[model samples]
Target: NDWHTAIIPNWLKTIYAEDPFFQKTATVYTIHNLAYQGIFGWRILEIAGIDEYGFLYPEIAELANVVDLMARGILFADVITTVSERYAQEILTPEYGEKLDPILRDRKDRLFGILNGIDTEELNPATDPYLAANFDVSSLDRRVENKLDLQRKANMPPNPDVPLLGMISRLTDQKGFDLVGQVIDPLLRLFDVQFVLLGTGDPHYHAMFRRVAEEYPDKTGIFLTFNAELAQKIYGGSDMFLMPSRFEPCGLGQMIAMRYGSVPVVRETGGLADTVKDFDPRTGEGNGFTFKQYDPWAFFGAIIRAVETWKHRDVWRKLQIRGMTQDFSWDRSARKYIEVYFKALEFRAAETVGGSRP
Candidate 1:
């Protein structure tokens, strides 16, 4: 049901509000993605036999026709949170808020952003069961074995000299797939690099990538769907990962790629802006490359920078190892969630004279 789809575990609001037993337990709602928040009109309320004849004047309730459920969740919950510190800020902006700006403004003091973490043991390239070879941050030379295996499986020409650019994401406007699909031919013509795209998305984007693979069989490979094992292989094998989202709340793929020695070349937006630091040649402090502009050329420019740095084999190897060594674990995120739960409990305690929990 669209209602339920819009409201995952949102029913707790009414339940916890009414039942003191449930209220004793605090709830910390994590907003992984906000764009798909549950939204509907007066009809839904009316269908449920809830009267809409009153309290419809506020600008937000006026759109009772389409109130983002997440927006309402923010106002209703004792505390709210998102995936990254930068994304936590981005959500307050009108452009990114998607009509939830006013509500977010009201609850600004209560919202906390926690950066997500990955399971190192499950994702390590050396221990991963999916990869063709086992290698660590130090023995990265062995990564090429997995790369060759990937190239052979995909029918791409085996060329260790050429950089392999990888992308594994749902093909969508949000992912900036529109730009990649439109400009892939030009990019292939311009560089000797190989692009390997894996994921299913809009039919047009899928067709476009298939066309690209057909046009340049040796340089372009498209897998139109994702498999967990295959994703691990690409992460451990590919030389570079590409993420050009229009707005990403927080991305897990780029982090995983770095853990597997794949340097990321991403657009600076949302969590991408927060996680991937633009590479610096002199200091060599940053992990990967980034571009601020959304234009196709800006994306190309970032790729060019990555290519220029790749020429320095030792430096590039160091960059990969540095990225693979980063930590983004769920435990850190879980602790932050626990903190929000405590805040919620405090709010619930304050509202109830009996001091019931939230």
Candidate 2:
């Protein structure tokens, strides 16, 4: 139905509109992105025949916008969460607040931010079928085999000497697809790097990358559709992952890349900032290279830094090995959510005289 997109806001309104069900059951709403909040009109709600005193008002109906719905959801939801703790706080600010600052502040105590986890078993470099040679956590030799295989598979010349910079994401303005397009020609010419990208998003980006690929056939490969297996191969075979998100709530690709033993070269924003620590060669402490500035040059400069490190085979190998070993699993994250759930339950029970855990 056309109203399915409006279901969330409608349901939230319905739950609290002199109804006993919301009072009966505890709900914790997870706001993954405030920007794309599902906004539908009161007309749809009226068509659905769900008019109530609180929900029938004109202002209430117009609150169907994404940001307002988030605020409304925060008001009614027993608890809420975002992907990371930093983002949880970021959403409460005026700059990063997304116009829900006051609402988020009102519900601050009940809100939680747990870093999302990736399915590591599926992403393990050792057992991935997409790679040419599937090895385990212990053997890094098979990694090289997969790398060479990916080169042959993508039809790019097997130049192990060149840094294979791979990216898999929705080619969008916020994703720094604009930045990539801005500096792509210069970056390709300047660095000994081969670009392999697999994604589909903005049509202009798809066309742009395709044109770039046609112009620099030997240097770039663009796959416009998202293939799960191809993404795995890209992660397994590529030397580094590229993500220069302008404002990321939390990203799964960088985590997936780390699991595949691919170092991330990303802009320091949102989850990328939290996950990919800046590389300090002397200490060898960070997982990948990161830059804070959002400009294309800053992103490309980080790539050059990665390339420099890649030239030193031993150092680069250590970075890849450490990334593969880093745990980005769902287990820890699930536990945190479980804690949040129980906390919500406790609060819910406290609000009801007869309510108690079964």
Candidate 3:
């Protein structure tokens, strides 16, 4: 149950209390994002047909004069989960909790974070129709054709030697466009890298990226619109993907890029930290490049390392293979959800037997 639909879960729970068959059933409420809790005026409580059930506790339903739907869901539901394990923990802090930290802290034991996975079949690079070339992990050499095609399509110089960097994200501060905006021009001036960005959000970023593309037409390719086909092409064609998010709940772009053999150069925050690892040249064990600091130089440093590693064909290929072989599919995550269900059931059973008072 999310805030927008929190009433549905509460209504179901009310009905469950009456029916003996479902009396002991546990209600699970999932918090996809805690920032957008549906806190409305007290009138909503009456509209939701729950005014009769007065919220006596301030923590349960009331946040000042408003009725916090998210709070009610958290209070009534037997279990709560966030999108990623790190994000679940992050929301318990004052910085990320959006004024709900105390309420979440109370239910820390019941809260869970099961990392979200992708539909591997739908995102497969081997069978994608939008790419100029179709290739699998073993046939990575054919990926160059796609790179060349993307170069031509973007009207950039068709130089396969120069590393191509791809970004498919919303142009927002949280997505780390602020850091990119700061260092992109300087990085372009120095490096022999070609950049292609596809996204649309925040008018200022649209103007900013478009200006950059105009200034460096030969090396920079920017499309200030969301195109799914172009996004797939970028995933397939690019040598490296970029996601320097300030804080990401859980990212699917990095996983998609890996599936297409594009190594991600990302900031170590939230799921980005959990997924992408720093590549060690000596060991050649990690999948992609990662940096801990949110600073622009840190992001640029990761990019530089990726480009340097790209110079060594054997090492670069190994990195791509490692990323591609990663199991980012839903099977593992689904099992974790099963475990959550059982844990919730166990908690409900214990509470029922003990006659625990809320």
Let me know the TM-score candidate 2 reaches against the reference structure. 0.88
Question: How far off is residue 23 in model 2, in Å?
Answer: 4.0
lDDT of 3 by residue, 122-236 (tens): 9998999999989998899999999999998799999899999999999999999999998899889998899999998999999999899889999988988889899999999
Best by lDDT: 3
Please give the lDDT score at residue 123 for candidate 3. 92
Ranking by lDDT: 3, 1, 2
Whole-model lDDT per candidate: 0.78, 0.77, 0.86
Worst 10 residues of 3 by lDDT: 52-61
* Candidate 2 local lDDT, 1-358, one digit each (tens): 1122334534644545346766545667787776765455446445546554344323223343222344556665567788888778888888777666767776799888888898887777777777787866578766777677777777889877778989999989989998899889998877678999999999999889989989888888788998988898898889899999888888999998888778899988778877889899889888899998889889888888998999898888788778878778999899999998898777766755554321
The candidate 2 region of ten consecutive residues with least summed lDDT is 58-67
Top-TM-score candidate index: 3
TM-score of 1: 0.90
TM-score of candidate 3 relative to the true fold: 0.94
1-358, model 1: which lDDT tens digit per residue? 1123323223444433576556555445677777776676656655644454344535344453544556545655666778888888988888887777777777788778888888888888888999999999778889999899888877898878899999999999999987786667777898888888889989988788878888999997789987887788889879999998898888988899999899999988777877799998988888999988788888878888998899899999989878877767788778877777788778666756564322
Clashing pairs in 3: none
- TM-score for each candidate, following the candidate numbering: 0.90, 0.88, 0.94
